[model samples]
Target chain A: MKKLKLTVAFDDGDYVVYAKLHYDRAPNLIAAIEKVVPFSNPVRHARICESEWMLSTPYLGVEDENFSYPDPGDISLHRAGPHFCGWYERISPIGTTDIFASVASEDLEEYRKKMGRAWEHPGAKMTVDIVEVDA
Target chain B: MNPIAQELFETGDRYLMERPEDIAAMRSRMGTRGQNMTVQIYAFSALGSSVDAMYLLQEAVAKDDYDFDTVVKFAVDWLSTLAPPADGSQGAAIIGHRASVHYRLDQLADLTSRASAALKQATTRAEVREILQALEHYYNQVRTWIDLEFPWHELAVKYAELMGDPAPRPAP
Candidate 1:
């Protein structure tokens, strides 16, 4: 199955939090993310793009209704859902660097607008990268 | 170590043994005369209900936190008042089937108690393993009985699938 990688950066002083995402089962993964993200209806914002076969949740301040991308595969919140929605991929041929470039190029303008001053800061970085991994 | 759990286990065991005898005697009194389809059907339904109660008792014991004794006592008292007195016309075949089910239910009750005790004392991997083994045996036995008794039931097929057993063959 195709898997996505996500690298998120937030300004909480010295420490930067990076999350990688992989959802083996979409429904369960959606439930897990909802627990962490504050949203009225998380699933609706987190749309599954059929064309790219990727799952995406809205960024913290993104205003667009249809800016869906592949989900960043992270599973730190084990008890967030009924079960684990991601597993480690040992033989992922797709490099993270290439996927990161595409996501940055495609969504950088939206990311800048939403993040404001944080987007321009040297440390202000958030990435949503998709990488295909051996199932 | 809830007193209720032990009480439920004992009560369930006693019912399994006593109820069948009561039904059998009622069958004898009717002198094997009338068909009494209503009584026969009730006896069959009671047998099925008792088996279900036994399984629930096992589940309560497995859960270990519930006051199973009180739950079981209430069930037994309710069943006693609700079940119709056995009529003598009920055939031996029906009685035999009920008896067998009661026996299995009793065995399951015993297994549940033992398994629960093992779980309570399980501080090590080996102890957990032993408890799991006991549970597995109990589950397999119940699954086999259910599959045979209700081959056409959708839940039976679902159970078989969950256990990785082949779907039951269509009734011949």
Candidate 2:
């Protein structure tokens, strides 16, 4: 039961943004996401079953099923292509997603709007850090 | 308030009342016949080009800009588009909806790949953001195609078992 951080840095590493993970609620997705910690990925705005902002965590091993629609500020991991995703708005994912974290920004809405397409930028890369919060 | 949003709300309210089983599907696990509401929503999401309409509707809800009639109309436009599965057979829309969801998923993956490639050619935050926003606009196009079609899975994992497209070891 811990919160992980998804930190994104782009513009030649001049910019950085952090999203907090909510693993306590979703015990199913943590292991898959953790194995590829400190991995770099670009964000994609996915719109299949539902359109939402998603970060990629390719080549991870996980098989947790907690199918649910995530709201804004929720971070989720789906094994379908091993996607490490976050929600910036109301759109849902195509299938079941085990939500493991969230962007722990004070103004989540602002963070979402500012980082809208930063991940899609070729230079944009995110490093997810698995941190345990104080109990 | 968009007129469509209003229509969507009335339809959803009426549908929910008449078919409690659809509500049950959302609350608990059920078969395709029980998932009429879920399929409709899924199709609606596929029909939408982007999350912008939901975003706008959310904004309206938060700001009290949306009235009762305007609330649900934006997402349930699919209700109007679905016919009785052509030959009036069961699971017709369910199969169709599954296909719609898969197609949209494929389309999104392709768009992301293409956008990333374009970003490679154009560096800088502004250029990258521009490309992403363009993709967003495309995602937003789902709304106009209310006339267009759109799964199951809560029916996918069952199939994912055959496709081996999902994860092997999930969170414990």
Candidate 3:
């Protein structure tokens, strides 16, 4: 089986990171995310979820899957506005979210820096796309 | 109406009031400088309360036909406040970046208008509940944006902090 990965590109592929999709745990969510591959949005920082940045995806709507507190590097979908959230550092427990993917450990440092900038200078453009990788 | 909701409606009435009268008061408060985010914040906060009142009313007024009309009246009254000042006096008093303020105001008005239209045709408690739910969603989004994105300075920052996320509650 091929592993699924999501490429999160910021500022039109200037800075990019790969997140391994948790298909085993959130298959439906992953599938829904795949359908919207190459999703583009303006990213903003989360006030409640510390060390997290979010992108409003008003277009994406899917049922909750594997919803729980997010750890650093975990990417999840929050159904309120149906936004996508990525936690780059240990965060306060705000509520549960559908965890579907995670940025690889090696990418955490850069991811943290990139997502952190949103706290001060937000509205950066972010693009997400699904890609196939070796299992 | 629930007692708490009734109290909230009265509070909202004080903040919003009728047009012309409240508009004149608001403009006078803005004065020549026209930079009063404080009053704007107060008005929006009161609107939040009114939205809550509508929700609470729905919870307890499911059996009362008259209660729905009361909720609709309160909603319509508050919705009137979102309209831009008639004499183009809105330029000075707008908080934050002008374009952002204008865009958000328009978006909020659009959402409210749609909800208002749907609410007019609604005949049952379940229908009203759905409308209130949409308004509640809009309120939370606006509140969050105000606290997180609005340019708060000095005392306003305290208010913004106070308005933070309503914290850790499950999203509806």
Better of 1 and 2 by lDDT: 2
Best by TM-score: 3
Q: Please state the Cα-based DockQ of model 3 relative to the true two-chain complex.
A: 0.06
Task: Write the residue-wise lDDT of candidate 3 on A25-127 in tens digits.
Answer: 7888777767756655556776656777876442343556776888889998866544678899886777888888888888888888777776655556666
Per-residue lDDT of model 1, residues B70-150, tens digit only: 544433332332221133221333224332233223444344444444344445433333333333322332322232222
Winner of 1 and 3 under DockQ: 3
User: In model 2, how large is the Cα lDDT of residue A72?
Assistant: 74
Q: After aligning candidate 1 to the native by TM-score, how far in Å is the CA of A27 from where it should be? A: 31
> Which of candidates 1 and 2 reaches a greater TM-score?
2
TM-score of each: 0.21, 0.38, 0.56
lDDT of 2 by residue, B43-95 (tens): 44543423444334333434434453344332223221221122222343432
User: Runs in model 1 with CA error above 4 Å?
Assistant: A1-135, B1-34, B78-172
Question: Model 1, range A17-36, lDDT digits (tens) per residue?
Answer: 22323243343444334443
- TM-score of candidate 2 to 2 decimals: 0.38
Badly placed stretches (over 4 Å) of model 3 are: A1-13, B1-33, B36-104, B119-172
Per-residue lDDT of candidate 3, residues B45-119 (tens digit): 644564465445445435674576777655544444553322332333323322123323444454455455555
DockQ for each candidate?
Answer: 0.01, 0.03, 0.06
